[model samples]
Target: MPQAQKGICAEPNLHALYLMFNVHEDHDEEVRRILAQILNIFDHYDDEHYEAMVSGVIAIGSNYWMELYPGFLPAELAPFPDMHCEDRHAPVVPCDLFIQMRADRADICHAMGTAVYDALKPHVELVEQIKGFRFLDGRDLTGFVDGTENPKGMHKLDVAIIGDEDPEFAGGSYIHIQRYRHNLSKWNQLDVPHQEEIFGRTKTDDIEFASEMKKPFAHTKRTNLKDANGNSIEILRQSMPYGDMKEQGLFFVSCAKSPQPFTKMLESMIFGDAHGNYDKLMDYTTAETGAAFFAPSVDFLKFQGMS
Candidate 1:
């Protein structure tokens, strides 16, 4: 098995910092070296604070992959699947690099961000940053538990890591992210029962409704898709709710062995089925940005970068 990056399947942390950047022209080699050895930056802090469980991920955006490595591409690598359905939107916001740092301590996550920025200074321009935290007992700001369907234990690796089918990219994972700005004021107007109906789950207990009880447009109904063979298309979800006094929403991130799962899930949510019943939750949240990236295996980053 290839050495997968530690952060890709890392357990949820108390704090996370996501940074997106655009690598400057003529700095490809320098950026490559920095990203290749980024683990050392993470290890430097993790060694002293193992209790913090600090982990990091360095990913190259779909658009920048060819620029960085002109030799070849990950077989399934593709740009963001920007989609629209009536009023629903999944907008594309491409970036050359995406780095995620997570740890139990917000301070450590911040420190990692500082170090990462320092290493890439002048070679990259920071475009966006979203700091996220565990919300109210691992529930979303919407007062519902999140990531309830995440694959557990070794199953996460099975679902999130690429296999021999794409040997060159084995152990790498396809990543898709969207910044959703939720209109909590509007969502809160609904009663618990109404909310539960939209989510297709019991809010307090976080239990999925029976298949027969699930509504066609409920989020779970739309996202819990199946492939042609009647198998569920799964992705390891790494979403968290982020909020400030003025803004609140989800930082939706997911990883899978291939990009198809992410694309298909989004389509199901936006386009719905032949009946045209889309995910009802889209009405309360706006997907502000979307990006696609590939987090290559650790060994690939280490050996391929300087090759």
Candidate 2:
């Protein structure tokens, strides 16, 4: 079995920092050097301080980095495609690198984030930086329990890591990240039972609604995808809620052996089924950015000419 990244399947803690960056064309060499330095720092501190992971994907229409590793791309790796239906639009914004730092304390996460930025400051431009946290009872900003259906234990690894199917990238995983901003004022105005109906789950108890009780456009109904053989396709989600008094929402992170599960779920939520209805939650949240990345194994990272 190939070794996967440490934090991909583990339970997240109280704090996280997600940084996205675009490498400058003229600073390719510098970026590689800085990545090596960052990786070295992470490896040196691999034990108890904090957990950090790094990954990158070539932007669509740009093969500068992909050209270095011939045929090493994830089978389903590609740029995030835009999603549109009626008045809602989920735009695709590509980034070349992603850095995720998580720990039990915000101060630790912040220190590591600062180190990463200091090393890459001259070579890359920051795209987005989000500080995520475990909200009250792990609920999202809207009070719905997030990731309630996530696969557990070895099932999470089975769902997330690439296996024999893609030999070259066996230890790697395809990831999709989205930054959503919620309309909290409007969301908070809905009554309790109505809010539960929109989520297909009980507000106070986090109990899922039975099939007969589910609405066609409910978020739960829209995201439940299955294969032709009726097996539920699953993804390991590392999502967290992030916001302040002025603006807040979810930093959606999903990892899978292939990108199909995330893409299918997303399309279903945005385009809906033959009935012509999308996820009801879309009305209360807007996806501001979308990007796809591939997190490779540690062994692969060491050999990427970083030394």
**TM-scores of the models, in the given order?**
0.98, 0.92
lDDT of 2 at 158: 86
After superposition, candidate 1 runs with Cα above 4 Å error: none
Report the C-alpha lDDT of model 2 over 14-101, residue by residue, as the tens digit.
8888898887777665665565566665554555453433222212212233743444566777777678888778888878888787
Best by TM-score: 1
Q: What are the clashing pairs of model 1?
A: none
- Reference-based lDDT, residue 180, model 1: 96
| Candidate 1 per-residue lDDT over residues 1-307, each given as its tens digit | 8888888999999999999999999999888888877778898889989999999888899999998877869999999998988999999999999999999999999999999999998799999999999997799888889998889999999999999989988989999989999999999999999999999999999999998999999999999988999998999988878889999999999999999999998999999999998999999999999999999998888886687
Q: What 10-residue stretch in candidate 2 is worst by lDDT?
A: 54-63
Please give the lDDT score at residue 144 for candidate 2: 85
N/CA/C clash count, model 2? 0
Q: How close is candidate 2 to the true structure, as a TM-score?
A: 0.92
